[model samples]
Target: IAQRAMEPWAGLMRSFRAHRDHVWCKLSGMVTEAGWRHWKSQDLQPYVDAVLSIFGPSRCLFGSDWPVCLVAADYQSVKRALDDCLSGLTEEERSQILGASAIEAYRLPL
Candidate 1:
């Protein structure tokens, strides 16, 4: 159902959904979204996979919400959780998600 709904708008939705050259931020808030107490890296994998599928590694960036993420886990825990979710990716792909994508997406100077 959700997939169907997104198909039609997929192209235009690139602004946030990640299509073509558009990028996406795979950031904090997963723990709360997955239920804080029971949240695990596995619980976030499906979502992470979906974003990676939609955006591809070259168009995805990692972001941290800092104090907001503190509601569920410390900064290190959040980083670990995202790292675990992305553990299966190739080193280059991981590099893209970790920083390269942001640099390209925002056209930031080196």
Candidate 2:
């Protein structure tokens, strides 16, 4: 049998559901070529909601990409980019995205 074609959405959902093995969602490069350029400034609520729909909230994470983010916005601007999207989520979810998810995923000592 031949290999399956790359379906980005299906693939992403599959990875997200594998949360039993891996927790946390870094939405850094998830958008399209054009979309990535605009993602930082645009309302990312839909995409954030989509991830919540598939993976729930506890597994989400935030990353600035610092250097990569510079392609779209300044370091501080990109670093603060997720503030709006995250406003709708619960405190627990925010905790995960801010640090808990990374701590768990990397098995880091906190």
Candidate 3:
């Protein structure tokens, strides 16, 4: 399994959380690690939980991974997977992952 497999990074995520003010995590480019043809939203939940648990919604942003992700999943599927993974969170947290975090991270001119 590659580094993207998510299990090994739980500890790293914890370590990284110490720098949460200076670090950000983009929830993208991971679906293929669950396997291109067989991946399901359930397979994605643990990874999402890890990040949200470690970084919280304010430190995360959704990423489509675009043409690269096309190797395993499409744009809508990627979004839906994140939505499923985020189901237990409050609406504001979900919104943070979907858009606001990116805006804050990049200091977007919105």
Candidate 4:
């Protein structure tokens, strides 16, 4: 599905038109997909990159699935994993993925 969505002829962008106002969480389900016991940032980078490419920094938010993530890694470890995957992004783009996008997406009063 990720590959299909990334294809130019798949009309993924057109599908996104209906969700133009929505933001996408680049986190979630990664640890499980990568394998709970033997996951690394490198293992998850392809999936993360795909999402970032499709959604761009402005519409992509980071999510720390907390207790769920704990089953695979510690809180800091999970965060560091994502940080590693996002290492090449600019500071502003990182900020968007880390927090700014979530604020906008959720319409928070902060």
Candidate 5:
């Protein structure tokens, strides 16, 4: 089974969906994972859409990788890129992805 039963991402999505009770996903670090020099937000849209579809807004959160991301993009660029990817969602969904989900995931006092 380990030889060819699963593609890495396919396996990951399956596992993620199966473990929804405790697992949540963070959409971040994309800039570092991409081309870095000339990558565009559009380049990340598909992956973002995939994560959102599988996890839904409630179980997905946004993260800014901060100083580590500076190697590939500035802080503002990273944020703007995620905002662009999230542009098509409803306001409530965007709010969930942007902030609400994090609060819930972390059980923050806010």
Candidate 6:
């Protein structure tokens, strides 16, 4: 399971290096560890950096787990937390994080 899971990360690194354009990447969701139910806090920044470092600010997106996030935080709180985490990024990047990335990825109408 570990090996299978890592393949996509490897592939993304390779692709990011190869393509100069932006790529939308999704991190693995909340994990199970030490009987504590929480998202991987430390891993978040580095992963965000990896994506931003490779694809720049325009390509990144934030996801609130919605009903899943509700397991620990309400939807509004989740949204606020995402906003706080992404506060350092540009407005354009923030826009991408909020919804633009999804529309672009799925080829939805703007």
In candidate 2 the C-alpha lDDT for residue 82 amounts to: 66
Count of clashes, each model = 0, 0, 0, 0, 0, 0
Cα RMSD of all models vs. native, in order, equals 4.6, 6.0, 2.1, 4.0, 4.7, 5.0
How would you encode candidate 6's per-residue C-alpha lDDT over 1-110 as one tens digit per residue?
Answer: 21224347746686766775545664323222111245434424454556666665556566666566555556665566456556688888888867787788778985
Across residues 24-66, which tens digit of lDDT does each residue of candidate 3 receive?
9999987767688778888888888888888888889999989
TM-score of each: 0.77, 0.69, 0.90, 0.79, 0.87, 0.58
Q: Clashing residue pairs in candidate 1, if any?
A: none
The 0-to-1 C-alpha lDDT of every candidate, in the order given, reads 0.73, 0.61, 0.85, 0.75, 0.83, 0.56
Looking at candidate 4, the ten consecutive residues that score lowest on lDDT are 1-10
Error of 3 at 13 (Å): 1.7
The sequence of per-residue lDDT tens digits that candidate 4 reaches over residues 27-69 is 6656754577778888878777877766788888888787787
lDDT of 5 by residue, 18-110 (tens): 866788889988888778787889888877887888888888899989889998899999999999999999999999989999998899996
Best by TM-score: 3
Which pairs of residues collide in candidate 4? none
Candidate 5: segments with Cα more than 4 A from true spot:
1-7
Task: Name the lDDT value of residue 74 in candidate 1.
Answer: 84
All candidates in order of lDDT, best leading? 3, 5, 4, 1, 2, 6
How many angstroms is residue 1 displaced in model 1 relative to the true structure, after the best TM-score fit? 17
Model 1 worst lDDT window (10 residues) = 1-10
Error of 2 at 13 (Å): 2.3
Candidate 4 local lDDT, residue 91: 96
